[model samples]
Target: MKLKRTIIISIFFVLMLCGSVLASPSSNNAKRINSTYISATTEETNIRYINDKFEVAPDKQWTIKFNKEVNPLAINTENVQVLDSKGQAVNITLGLSSDGKHVSINPPASKYISGETYSLIIKKSLSNKLNETLPKEVRMKFTIMKDNSNDTGNNVNPVLYEARQGLDKIYNLVKTDKERALVSALRDGVNTKINNPSATIDVNPLKDQYGNLSSDEKSDFKNAILSNFSIGALFEIKSIFE
Candidate 1:
């Protein structure tokens, strides 16, 4: 089973390399349509150290077979850094793919300490000579696998609560982490105005595995931070699953 798991994971990485290119039309649309990948197996669950789909860790690998061929470019991993909760950075590098499709990220073995969640970020993106500027950076949220306890319904998860709260601050036009990060990433400089660009936003039902929504069920999640959340919320309450 272990060998089989390793083989499957090896195959998964190759496909990801091909798909990681950011310059492709599909990838560009991912910013709009969004993709959420769910990894349910024991092997995959162990890799990301998270139960949810779409988020992953550098140490883990998986296999995905696609019908079409994708031309993916090489990415420079020197600029990729893992940011801790306090926002300190640890460096990671790109692991060469054996197949044209597979890609891997190798962080220092020492950094995989027990019991802490860390966010992954790519400071610089890779672009090849073919005008195929792709192999884009990872997403914004922190990915941690170490020592943090799962949130209990009894005791609120302050970090998630704060993260949600930060979004609220942005929605209310107050200074918030979402506003800060979005403007900081998109802005030219301090006090400079940034324009809102139209893109397809992923409007998905943020339901649990059982597909149930509590009383406050009006809003749809767009996988967006403060600057983008407005696109996801619906004026009318949508699906109600039992």
Candidate 2:
């Protein structure tokens, strides 16, 4: 009777061990995304930004790398989507690498709109070779480069060009040397503030210079500058006087 009871206890432990092994997650189930990027150029790998605000060429190709080998069947257009700023879907073709560990996305021709933002979405239904799905859907945002050419004239962002022209007009309107000097000082202060890493910037110097102008002139000047350049770039011009 003692020997039989001992044998039964051993059998029970063996069954428990087997059950634990079966319940453990498999290697494929542990797989996850290792990295992602836009292949901007032959030598460049533009790493994916957490904020999803990548600036890329109009014809940029996207790539996603997995920590483990994936099932080629898991990658498809239905699992991946590219959406424009307006939330309209952009057509794309999906391809898996030879090892099935990487997926590449080829967006439709002319699908990327210049100066616009886009989102690359990976659905949660995407699974690995073991049929283990991702924990959550992934969404990444990117912006097509406003100007992506080597030609000097064409390479300039249109809004930047317009902003520079507005600055030129402002410079011309400053009739006195003192007023021109104040504008120059303001430009320098703004540029300095932009280059600084600190978030809270003191624009008192620029504000003082701006106070010298008439209220109506100030309003018109502000409108011209803001309309031409995004508020973000208006502070970083190399030469506002030019």
Candidate 3:
């Protein structure tokens, strides 16, 4: 009777081990499936990354895809946003696919400015049709590159041409870390002014940085901007920095 009891105990332990072995692969497969459903992708043909930031065209648009259908109500700008380097939100238009598994992020009417960095923010508040939100927020940083192709057949403004020339000189002269940072902050409005003759950008963002510069640095700033920017551009810059 003791020998029979030992045999029964060994059989029970063996059964338990066999059950776990059989269930392991199924558990792993479920996690893999879940990851795909929660992920997203962009539709760019040749996506490129530099210094952990995406290098995109000035007018680039993003098409995000998911394995699960998204809730239509979660498709507004509040859930999906684009913000400039200063953390100011850029107005964007969103288009949802009929199946709701894809959404497109379109740039503003002025599009993005070349030589500026922006962030595309996907909040955790975004939910699917089942009302399940994302596990975390997603933020992507990108820098805009000038799209020469878009300039074709457009008449060049002479004042903009001179302004760009002055900016090129300033770019070559930057040496200190502070100077570089200041130029980077100023590039967005400056680039826009040259790229679009009619564009009137708010230069108020440059105030604090400009105030921190040394006297010589401030003189260079005035010479580069005041001497070259168009009359309208000069007015905005002067009002903000002077």
Candidate 4:
């Protein structure tokens, strides 16, 4: 009887130990984000990252993506902040992608300053759909390259320079004379507006040029334009043709 009682007690302790092990959370089983990327547009093809920094166009929207789907409710301006070198938060609007794995941050209508360093802060509060927090908080630093035309002085508008560069790229990409002419007209119109803000804008010559391009080409064109121009310049151009 003594041996039987000792055996029963051992069995009870073993069961209890098993229960505890099952109830405890397993660190090895925790889910984590697989990867991340940043882009100037919503298209995945345009996404880019360099050494933990995103080289973004001044006037474009910034899209941040995680390989794992995130909890939409947890994504907000409070959890993601864009700070300048001085650590002041820049005015921005946050938007989530349809898949709930990406967020788009739009700066104030003015766009980011060229040749300036900015930090994108993703706070610890952000979590995946499973309610698991990121392995750690993420802070990414990036710099907007100075506009090519700004070589002479700081007075040149970097956004405008970017717009011109975009137009130049488009011109080089087109093979047909009609497309080239349309791009040239658009480029000329933009240049006129930049050189003389009061000049009467005319985008009518190229109004229909974009209607026939493939979706990929359209995205590429948009990226070029946004990369080269500032929000203000875009607004001025829009006021003419939009």
User: Would you list the C-alpha lDDT of every candidate in the order shown?
Assistant: 0.29, 0.49, 0.54, 0.52
Give lDDT tens digits, candidate 1, residues 102-213. Answer: 4445556664443233555443243333434333333343332322243232232222222232233333242323323332222111001101112221212111210242
Model 4: per-residue lDDT, tens digit, 1-242?
Answer: 66754443333223212211000111212222223455321112322222223234676566777888888888787888889978999888888888888888787678888545577877777888899876556665554543446445423333444444555565555444444445555545544444444455533334455566666665555444434444454444333322
Listing every candidate in turn, what is its Cα RMSD in Å to the true structure after a full C-alpha superposition? Answer: 20.0, 28.3, 27.0, 29.4
Model 2, runs deviating above 4 Å: 1-49, 148-242
Better of 1 and 3 by lDDT: 3
What TM-score does each of the candidates earn?
0.32, 0.44, 0.42, 0.41
Worst 10 residues of 2 by lDDT: 20-29
Identify the leading candidate in terms of TM-score: 2
Candidate 3 ranges with C-alpha deviation above 4 Å: 1-53, 147-242
By summed lDDT, the worst window of 10 consecutive residues in model 1 runs over 20-29
Q: What is the lDDT of residue 43 in candidate 3?
A: 19
In lDDT terms, how accurate is model 2?
Answer: 0.49
Model 2 clash pairs are none
Native-structure RMSD, model 1: 20.0
- The order by descending lDDT is 3, 4, 2, 1
Consecutive 10-residue window with the lowest summed lDDT within model 4: 19-28
Q: Runs in model 4 with CA error above 4 Å?
A: 1-36, 39-55, 148-242
